[model samples]
Target: MKLGIFLLAAQFEAGDQGTVLTSAMDAGCAAEEAGFDEAWIAEHHFVPYGLCPSAVTFAAMLLGRTDRLRVGTAISVLPNTHPVALGEQAALLDQLSGGRFTLGIGRGGPWVDLEVFGSGIERYDEEGWAESVDLLMRWLTLRRVGAEGKHFRFRPVPVVPRPLTRPHPPAIIACTSATSAALAARQGLPMLLGMHADDCEKAEMISAYDAAARACGRDPRGVEHAAASVALVADSRAEAVRELKAALPRWLNRGLSAHQTVDGRARTMRDPHAYTDYLCEIHPVGTPRDVIAALRRTTEATGIRRHLLFAEGAGRPERTLDNIHRLGKEVLPEIRADAEQ
Candidate 1:
């Protein structure tokens, strides 16, 4: 049961960007000290949703502070950036983390995000994402790889530095659909299940990932499945709820609102009416006991190996830090250490 702490460095308040970033840094340091396996930073743009336009840059900042924690972008939207350039950036980050970088990539979905990148709504479809990822994989491994399909072809120069970790670090996908899961399975990359509601959904997604992998003649052992359920752990369920009410709008609203605008499709979380209805059902936002019970239930249902907890607070870093310490000291030990089990 490997636990991860998820961080997103977004400008929540209008002022003090540096101060907010420092708080995020402090949170990462706290996560490392709390004995978690990783701290995943997310990527976003031109919005208060997430100020972290460059997640690898954020990784470099954490590498200097934490000893063992692997620094990763929860998922870098590959379609928006040239894979070749991002591959080089990831290589540098892999070295910076002392080979502790995990490469998590996804196709940007928030309609606005895709629009910004000049990719249309049709690009959000599975085929588009698959094409983008396939090209990315080829470019990262074989510099001159050429393709004549629906998407990409690049004149190749062998990308230098070539990543410090074998096969260019473990690859992960931020999963949204069965098609995406199938791609992850076929490619033997782990699925980072996003936008799920609870334990039942997670278990179902894990099964889906493994099934897709096995069906593709890929080893199930090579297909890692994990999910980040927004948890605000505290001493009591009441306090957890209070904290969640205050903090959760930042994560859920930001996440659910993010989908791609390809194929003439532009979407927005612009519908504020849906926020409350969506989060209440999906997010785990209570005490330690409530979180543990919810997580155990979800794990039992989903069979996920890794759990990433996305949580942080400005005025109460202590509470966030305390939650992680308790998670490391208590939550992980109770779960069977072997992921395969």
Candidate 2:
């Protein structure tokens, strides 16, 4: 199985922006040294939910720092940016990195991002996202193209400095819903499944994606889907649970509140134990052995081979570093070995 890390670069506390970004970059370096395949960064605006607002810029910084590790945007929010401009930036980064860049694009969410970015909620629908993706693919693949779509219109123009990876670098869709999964499959694109989904949800989503791909006359086996979850590896399950009990709730509450609303109030989970129980049931958060078992169960359930670990959250940098080290030294090899068998 291929292993990667997702750098949320979350700012959990006030007056800690610099520390958060520095720790994130350091984590990227550590992930490379620890034998991770890729480092995916998140993009968010006007919030500490994710400190990095421009995943392409952050990806450039990481690509400059790492020799072997591929750097990608977990997603660059599509509706807020111009597709042609994004295509140019991605192509340039792919060239600069010698084909080490992947463009993961998505319709960003929770309704608040659209309002914050001045892209009204009306534009956050599937039609808008599909139009953006269509324009983006055309920009990346064609030498000269013109679009006459409702959302975008332009004269035929050539894109300079085409990407290093021939037609363009690989593009993966961030799939959070069944509609998005089917869209990805219809386009023959891979998907990055979010960490918040349970095993049953993931299985259903993957099954839907595979069926959609096959229905589209595309081979489902050719699709490379990744499942993401918050992970921490420690000496024992007790140690892991203790640390997670302190940290995961903060992360979950921040995430949930940031992404959802009820009657104009932010949604939140107040009970840490209940939230932690849900997390332990869904994520790979425990000792190496426990993580291995959890991941094995997930793979068995979903048939996914790529696992992306969100190792940084409300935890301290030292603890996050330790978790990465243990994941590299203990969990990854076992997962790979099991995959071989």
Candidate 3:
């Protein structure tokens, strides 16, 4: 199985922004040294939930720092930026990284990002988001493209710095819902499924994605799907779970607090106990042996080949490096061996 680290660059303590950013880059270097294949970074705005506002810029920095580790956006919020600009940036990054860039796009949630970026919530709706994705693909693939849509209008214009990766850097969709899964399938793109989904939900979603892809005249088996989950492989299962349990609440609560209704209702953030229960139910946190078992079960159920390990969340830099080390030294080889067998 392909293994990668997901860096959220979240700030949990009162520290200099430079320190947090440095730690994130350091984590990417560590992941590379530890034999990880890729490192994906998240984009957020006006919140400490995620410090990276421009994933493309951050990806450039990491690409320059690492020699072989592929760098990508966990997601570049589509509605928040222009498709043309994004395509140009991604193409340049792919060239600079020697074809080691993956462009993951998503219709972000109804959050402060939209308000802060002045991208109205309407653009985040189904129709608008679909339009954005279409335009993005056009910009990436076509030499000269024009589009007339409710969300975007452009006369025929040339897109320079075409991506080095044949058609374009692998463009994957971040699938959070069934609709998103269908969108990815229809576009013949892979998906990045989040950790919030349980095993049953993940399996169901993957099945739906496969069916949709087949309906679109694409081969489902050939498409690569990735699953993101918090993974911490420690010497003992008890230690791993304890560390994860201690850090997870902050990440969950912060996410919940960031997205809320106009009427000031924080639905998911209200219940800490339920959040903890849900976290334990979804994440794969334990010793190397236990994590491998859990991952194998997930792969069997969902046919996920790429496992995006989110071991850097909740702002624990030390723990993040340790998890990456243990994953490389103790877990990854076993997982690869099992796959080979």
Candidate 4:
């Protein structure tokens, strides 16, 4: 199994943007040092849930900071940005990083981010999202490309610095629903499952994706699917849970509540404490053995081999770094051993 870190850049403490950002960077460096395969950056706007507004930009920085580690956007919100421009950035990063970049895009929520970025609420719709992803794919793959879609109208342009990865650097779609899974399958790309869903739900989505791929005459057997899960390692399960319960809920409560819809659409926010409990139940936490078992169960259920572990559940950089180290030292070896079997 390939292991990676999910860098959310979540600001857990008030007025600590710089510290949080630095910690995120440190986490990426630590991930590489800890022998991780990749570090995926999260994109969020006007919220502390994730402070990085431009995942690609942040990814570029992380890529430069580490030589062997592959860097990617857990998702660069497609609705709020121009696909061609984003594609160009991805290609540039891929080339510079020696093909160590992965571009993961998603149809972000109907949040005020659309208004702030002047993308309009219409861009958040199904049609707009599909068009953008298609355009992006073309940009990454074709030498010269143009788009004449409902949301974009552009003349053919050269794809400069053409990605070092043939066809394009690896592209993943962050998907939660069956519709999005189908889209990813149709595009012949893999899905980046989130931590919010349990293993069974993830398995269902994978099934949906496989069905869609088969219907579209595409084989899904070789796709390297990835899933994000929370990780916090301690001497015991109770200690790990205690550490996460004390801080993660507060961060979730503040960050989730900060989201505002552009059209005043009702967005049901989860109860942070309850959600944390749910994550603890589904995700890998506690001792290395416990984490390995959790991850093994998830892998078996979802047929996933790549894992993006979110190790900042304690909302402290030191603790987060410790988790990364332990993950690489204790958990990764066992996971690889199990995979070999």
Using TM-score as the measure, the top candidate is 4
How much is 256 displaced in model 4, in angstroms?
Answer: 0.5
Clashes of each: 16, 0, 0, 0
| Residue lDDT tens for model 1, 97-151 | 6788887898766456666777654455677777778776765666456567776
- Candidate ranking (TM-score, best to worst): 4, 3, 2, 1
**Which number leads on lDDT?**
4
Model 3 TM-score? 0.94
Question: What is each predicted model's overall lDDT from 0 to 1?
Answer: 0.69, 0.83, 0.82, 0.92
TM values, all candidates: 0.85, 0.93, 0.94, 0.98
lDDT of 4 by residue, 1-341 (tens): 88999989999989869889999999999999998889999999999999999999999999889989989899999999898889999999988889999999998799999999999888888888898899999889989998788889978888886888987789999999999999999999999999998989999999999999999999989799999999998999999999989998999999989999999988888899999899999999899999999998988888999999998889988988999999999998888787698
Candidate 1 lDDT (Cα, whole model)? 0.69
Per-residue lDDT tens digits of candidate 3, residues 166-259? 7767889999888999999888899899877877888889889988888888888878888888787777767776776677667656655666
Q: How much is the lDDT of residue 292 in candidate 2?
A: 89
Per-residue lDDT of 57-129 in model 2, one digit per residue for the tens? Answer: 9999999999999888988988878889899999999899999999988887645666666655555678878
lDDT of 2: 0.83
Model 3's alpha-carbon lDDT is 0.82
List candidate 3 stretches off by more than 4 Å: 260-270, 313-315
